[model samples]
Target: MAGENVLVAVEGRRLQLSNLDKVLYPSDGFTKGEVIDYYSRVAPVLLPHLAGRPLTMRRYPDGVDGQSFYEKNAARHAPDWVRTVTVDTPGSSTGAETLDFAVVDDLPTLVWAAQMASLELHIPQWTVGPRGGRNNPDRLVFDLDPGPPATIVECCRVALLLREKLRADGLEPVAKTSGSKGMQLYCTVTTTAPKQAWGYAKELAEQLAAEHPGLIVARMAKNLRPRKVFIDWSQNHEYKTTVAPYSLRARERPTVSTPITWAEVESCREPGDLVFTADDVLDRVDEHGDLFKPLLRKKNPPKLTALKSR
Candidate 1:
């Protein structure tokens, strides 16, 4: 199966895909072909969120039960048609000052990445400028992680509180399941410096943690997180990335980072209520038509500066 290949044409591009029968999710018996199919169907909505952003892929060459690695540098053997951007990585661990990262802006690129078993695709808040430079972040994100005794139920509570605060600041927020143990909140913003965005998120998180000391933990200490939600504001950093919406996570099953409605968050009573599989996501997309699409609006988005000094 590993050596077998299927040649297909996608949007005038020819690609050779392999190992379609290989089971990537052993528990679900989900194969590589299914993974590609999922991406294909979801591409219409998924591509906009990924366009022009540098991507960090989580690869599972041997399946979810096997070893995996993060791929920041585009594969040397990647097709010449694959677009990439070389960015500076100051104080690099591998001693390279810069890395060439893949930009998945089209359906063909998405399929090729799936063929390599890149189950999770991670991206930052900013998009690359037309001139190959980094633009200011156009969105801000809050990664709400739950500690051991805590779960999505608790994350939902914190999310509701964040919604109130964000709305008061004139910014609208949207919710999404992390496809792991927690959830995330995203808000569109006028192009703002990453440092400013990070500062706003950090201050807001600390403020909420102060108001609801028992329910939220703004700091990253493992001991402080017991039975509380850790509002990971640091994800707003320019170099940091959050899982792309609709991306499959490297979990025991093919869980997806799914966009959700506020009503669902308000009524979430158990962790199972928020968990979504790849199949579940496809169905929801057909019904909801990209609930997170509001984040893509470029007109008159609120500025993060209003809350920075609060």
Candidate 2:
């Protein structure tokens, strides 16, 4: 892990990288250089979703298998040019405190984060808003996580069902692999109210779980995770974060959270169908532009509470 420094200019920005040859994914022998290269290459497409969001960086200083830590507060060492957003956090019992979170405003900052050996990027459902305005969730996520003995295929089936329900509510939905063993579905939200998204998602999840008892579980209880897939509605909260699409995972191997088409979701028959490595994801982006872009783009928000009126 002890290596010398190598200076490089990233888009005219100076960065000194160390231990680029350090193995992060020892199982596949993928080095830190490969991680940096992957983020740098994917920055153009990846940055849009990350534009104004506070990033909870997952740094793998000793690689994926080794010691890893989540960095919420921007490092004090960060250069002045690196943009950050200060948001209020619920502290103690009386009031709130501010946290300075890194906002990857440009490709230079993206590469610099890679220089820190941050293997994964996770962003909240909402952005920091213009001029760091009110934090609200612009989208909602339904994380279909399967229990043991079940896999991505099961989650895929459940995702399709969730998609249909969201579509019925007059909202278009998109599906993506979680880069690990699970899958996530996203829908563009119109409400700026902090609780609307979570309320809608929780209601929908409970309704579905009630409609299909054995196959689904909406509650976040450990005992409920037997041969069932959990619809994680809790991700819709403003304080929570979901894995950024196209971000790398800290799994045993370097897998990416790649977006998928609806047809791909329909044809997903097994776990392997949902997996994409860093190289595979890069190739996919080259062939097809970002399909998950709609979630972050301006769109009409559906009155999810109206669905309850039915």
Candidate 3:
């Protein structure tokens, strides 16, 4: 019993009903109470982990297949603060029914979206990003990304190693899944000239690659990294786009870009071992607060700049 209100439509006619606290999602229905329950359970773990910032959750209806559905509707609900955009959809639709909400705010919104999209529609999985929401950030993506056969553990190791090095340079590094087989390392920096940002990231990545040799490969093209992780700098460009923050991808089981703790990184050996579902992410969010908040505050978000040289 979160509350009472259901905005519905009948035969092309809209109807507003009172004392209706239940949400009738095509995949699964939830009452406002359920959403609130999840929030209370998860917020504690998620709040501290955030980069000391407010979170912006991307709702994927019916999982990744429902990405387009969400993207089309996101414009209406997304707060005015988002900036960076990336999508993790598998490029397909779930082919399921959908419902709409007028104002889905706060952590409750996340629980409702996950339950409805994942449980109700049965889409594959979901991926997520930091809650810069419109003002989030256009990350300087160093895709030290590896391909199949690369264990998640190995990828995470590379990420952690990079994290240590980046921290020494006064840059905060936050890691997330590529929503595929690799990991993405995002560093928050001041809105220096775009060239400065790109130059800083490129230099750092290239230096790391040189230090690791076989373990780290710095190449712009995918073909170059037949088996190694490529440090992609193109994402650092101002106009360049990554996946939308909460866009879903077309995976059969529906996974999300859930956060991982340094403890998990220290203990795990493969990325596959860390796959997380929509039902489980909020708990982690509660545990960690926001991992990207430190970096976001250190660096003043993204800014427009002329392209810089390598």
lDDT of each: 0.92, 0.86, 0.48
Off by over 4 Å in 2: 91-96
Better of 1 and 3 by lDDT: 1
- The predicted structure with the larger TM-score, 2 or 3, is 2
Candidate 1: 10-residue stretch with minimal lDDT? 301-310
lDDT by residue (186-276, candidate 2, tens digit) is 9887775888899899999999999888889999997998889999999987778899998999999999999999889889888898889
Candidate scoring better on lDDT of 1 and 2 = 1
Maximum-TM-score candidate? 1
Please give the clash total of every predicted structure, in order: 0, 0, 58
lDDT by residue (tens digit), candidate 3, 65-173: 3453333223344434322233322332643233221222234433433333322211111112343222333345566567545556667778887888766665556
In model 3, state the lDDT of residue 297: 53
* Alpha-carbon runs more than 4 Å astray in model 3: 1-139, 243-249, 296-310
TM-score of each: 0.97, 0.95, 0.56
- How well does candidate 2 score on lDDT at residue 202? 91
* Candidate 1 C-alpha error for residue 6, in Å: 0.8
Give candidate 2's error at residue 224 in angstroms: 0.6
- Models, CA RMSD each: 1.1, 2.1, 9.6
